[model samples]
Target: MRKGLPILLALMMASTAVGARAESIGHADLARLNETVGAIGRRLADTDARKSDASALLTGRLAGIGAKGQWQVPTFDTLAGKPTLHTIPVDFMLAQLRLQTGGKFAPNAHKAIANGAAPALFIRGGVMSLDELAKLAATQHPGAIEQRGQSFIAHWPIVIWSDAGLVLSAGQQLELSTGEGAFVLNSGLFTIDRASLSSTPEKNAILPEFRPFLATAMTGAVQAREARFSNLGYGETGVTSGLSIVGAALYPAKMRSSFSDSSFVGLNAVSLENARDIAIVGNRFQKMVGPAIAMSGVTNSQILGNVMMGTRMAQAIDVQNRTSDIEITGNVVLNNRGSGIFIANDARDVTIEANLLSGNGRGGVSVVRSACIDISDNVIVSNAQVGIKIRASDALSLSGNDLIANAGAGISVLDQQKGALISVADNAFSANKSGLYGGAASEVALNANDFAGQSPILLDGEFAAYVPELLRMSSSPEGAPQAFTIHPNAKSTTGQTSRPDCKTGS
Candidate 1:
């Protein structure tokens, strides 16, 4: 009994601790929760009332319709008797959806309806609910109707089989859910002119798998794909190429505080994969987790007139894997975790021009294993690492760029593959720890750069054969020998000394 007393005391203490950790809801908190729940239920009731009113209005509008009419709204009992088909204008179906969902169509949708660009459908006669009718309409057309909270948002991704295309005019709003949005696949001439596409934050927080707002894919034969003047938010992605996104504001999710770290790859503002002739112009990409724009295996793409900022954990623009002929111009890329622009892995024929890249955690630009890159006319400044780091690449032309106030070397060219040709001409380098550092087998064509009041160019590795040329070009325009310096690891050539300055015999 004495030994068992300790065990019994321990069990009692454990139970007391467990009870102490348990929390009970206060009466006020419970009351608040009840009130919130009641409010939600009341809101739902109001929505149902609105739906009923709209349905009554629609029924009154179609009351005098007789049999064999093109616009027929048969009663549920009438539809149950025989299998009848009715042809209705697409806009009428949209109107029915608006009545059912208690939502409004975008102005672009109205304009399309007015212009007769909206398609007509032959709906089968059946006793179906409003949701059923919406599903049926979506199946017949290349669009979707999604139920979001008290509103059901409609999307019309018109399929262009011929020369005539679909156009979404200004002041339109579209809501999407998981696996439901607009897609232009194998279509031609798709255009969105000043519209808004959004995913409801309430729905997105509840539904984990959300799709993009707009996408174009496998459109090799398309004439054009363009989106201009739009506000898009709370989607997996705003756009996917092959298309041009111009003058748009793209957000990862609805404007909320919780989405600051929500930079999932699927939620990129623009994602381009295996795309050609793509253009992203005059756009804003902000508060995203992954890259603001990601291009993979793309060709002939241009990123112009864009502002990319406040990305969570990635670059503003990431180009990877065989992407060629890309021009990144007239853009502002700032305050990102990774490099502002990262070009890597077999990308070629790329140009970075006339951009402001600053305040990034990593370097402004990083090039790895790519060739034929032209870095010109850019202000690269105040980054965590080197302004530009080129690794294992060839055929680089670095001209007319301002490399300033960086944490590391302004320009670092390291581990050059054999027979690589690098050209440095007409650039300004200032206020960096080191202006330039060239490593093994760097065949640099150095000419006419302004390096006054900057650190000397540090050359490393073996340069026995090219030492004379290096010394000759090391002098400034005023003929001073301190502009270029050789690293200690550099091998001594004939008639040369191991000195920091590039002077005669030293």
Candidate 2:
């Protein structure tokens, strides 16, 4: 008897499945759908109904509950330009949009509205909903113009433009216009990491800029007025690096507290470590505590055409630790307390060219433990230390430089550096200590220079001094102190006993 019951239950289940599948929408069903739609249109509408209400009819037809407990939503393909007034409900419309366009409401809006009747809205059964009719109306209606009064309001986690409305995400071609009007973002704080919004004169598109703040961690600073803690991150480690505050200009006095308040002047430490293809150009870095650009363990970096000035305590450009193939050119560095440019700690294949450095307290340029560095066409002036310093380096070349007013040697090489082997040609040195100094270096070549300083430039250490005759300085008048003696009171005497030769192997 139990086996018989099992067989009967299986037969009954099969019959139910077949009946459900075989059931089809009937002509009566269609008639009822039409009637329900008409009734919906008349319910909330006045007798002198505007033509816009026709959208309700469309919503009702698409909102029918099927026999299988499934709901059907209308799509553009289903409408096919039929002219009956269809009122799409809001729920159906939002659902349709969410389904069809993947949350992009702008693209398909016009077509959806034009092809349907007046869209409808309802509040029933403890639920607020939109009929297909309302969807059609809203889609067809012109988008609201951005209102000026409500441009920036606090909207937790973000301060959005009142005019921009509710946007899940902005498209690539996003451009915000604050023309003749002011827009303020005052969300207490907001983030713009990797989201671009540019309204400058250059381009007119949404999201013109790619990375306003391209990082994960942020605190204060966006609209932090009178706030104590404010910071941004720009480290490549994907952890907190506190460098997104690099180029942001701020005033310390305006902040709420003076705990660690400082104004933004230049780039903080940028983590280009082990990263490749870095290019820094056309930036104005002023009064920064860190290097204008710091790259280490990186490859194929190009730092060019930047203005670095008034740094607090570091070099303008600091490259270190096995970096290679870097090109630094056409930059202006001024008034740094440290080196204008420094390449040290095993960097190789670096090219420093066409830079203008002046008023540096320390060495204008310094390269240590580096190889294949080409220094050319630079104007170094008024630095307290040597114009260029090379140590523990190899295959270095210096040419076409104007080293002026340096307190130390025009170009100094030490510790077996290949500076002497490099092509030192067509360089001009005026009022420098020693035009060129070499120590223990091999294979140096000095050719076609314009050395204008004290006569008989000194070379120290075990160097095979080539072109020592060419190292002669420009003429000085009777008592001009022969290249402005290191101490103003002292003078260079002519006698052999007075002249102590401080050459490498004297």
Candidate 3:
């Protein structure tokens, strides 16, 4: 201060001289302005120092925890029924569990521990019981937490009473050994990876019905990968109202009943009813008694990149009961007892694309009483019945597909009701019994398709009127046999033969 006083005095004199030349200005205002600027500079410097200290503290804490090679549990004095705020790392709480339980944790707990580092959580702490803390830890981490020696064996169902979260991390396993199913009463989120859930088989006369591994009536997301479900009756996984099931694997019992029971027929691998905004992606469904994936009254959903095989008595994927706006893409459906993909019961606005459907007992794709469907870019072959079958459907577009070696027609249209419009374009058909079969009342637009090695475009009943148009739109390679062949009984409504020479008739 003493050294700067002379310069400050000179500056003040200069300001006074300037003020005299101008209107009468005071020196006190200049002094106050200088002081305020100095104060602000000091405050900013302090703030930066504080921020540096905070950063150092966080770095040191993380380093210290790593150096210890074991978690250090924080000590907290209990305040019953009093709410307290805590800013703590989730690992600290997990460490506390290890301390309380003497390091004896379940396999799933260990999996939760290894999935990833725990996040620092700011929680409103209260009188949290151990159970509540376990659940919190499980939710914050990515694995399930189980109490020590808690047997899942029970005759009645295991019901989650309130809002909850369960997770099973990679390399973790959880088997629910129950005669009955598990249920979630309230909303929940379940994340599972590489886990198994199953039921113990009951003796004769005590067979369980509708005993799925996990069933929920609440709204949530079930995100699983490499998860397994087996030995459960009805469906292995089920959701009644709301949920998205993504990336799961489901298998039936090793030895299941063969009585052809209806309860077992309609429900098996995965069941969804009255669900919306759902997505089933990248799952494997194998050897199930009923449909691998069954939905009713569902809408606005996507089923993508899944594989379903060896279905016992139902379609690989079944959509029924007015489900609408569904997109099924890039799936492989093979060796099912019924149709590879079944769309029925007024389902509308559906798209099936880029799929491989083969070796199914029924048609590769079956549409019954549905409307506004688009099927494209699929390889449908070696099915016991037609490659693609449409019955009582309207506004169908079948394009850019490969239909080959099916036991029945490449494309079969039957019982086409009024107002139906079928469009066939850019498809390659080979070695099927018949390339296209049209039944009564079928109005077809055939365009730019390749037909080879079989009878192509067979029309029955009222469909004969479209023969000239179908012939004009279809073609075969040069030096190959003529592609279009008409049945002897085929007659146009204008009383003309089914010939290319015939004129187009209404």
Best by lDDT: 3
Q: Give the top-scoring candidate (TM-score).
A: 3
Using TM-score, rank the candidates from best to worst: 3, 1, 2
- Residue-wise C-alpha lDDT for candidate 1, range 259-340, written one tens digit per residue: 1101122244556655565555545555566577777777776776555666777888988888889988766566778899
Q: Could you tell which candidate, 1 or 3, scores higher by lDDT? A: 3
Per-residue lDDT of model 3, residues 8-47, tens digit only = 3223222222101111112353344234323322332321
Our model 2 lands, by Cα RMSD against the true structure, at 34.9
Q: Give Cα-based local distance difference scores for all models.
A: 0.48, 0.42, 0.50
Better of 2 and 3 by lDDT: 3
Off by over 4 Å in 3: 1-156, 180-186, 208-210, 235-267, 456-469, 472-506
- 364: Cα error in model 1, Å: 0.9
User: Global lDDT for candidate 2?
Assistant: 0.42
C-alpha RMSD values across all candidates: 23.9, 34.9, 29.8
Per-residue lDDT of 65-140 in model 2, one digit per residue for the tens? Answer: 1111111111110111222222234345434423432342212221212213333322111111112222333454
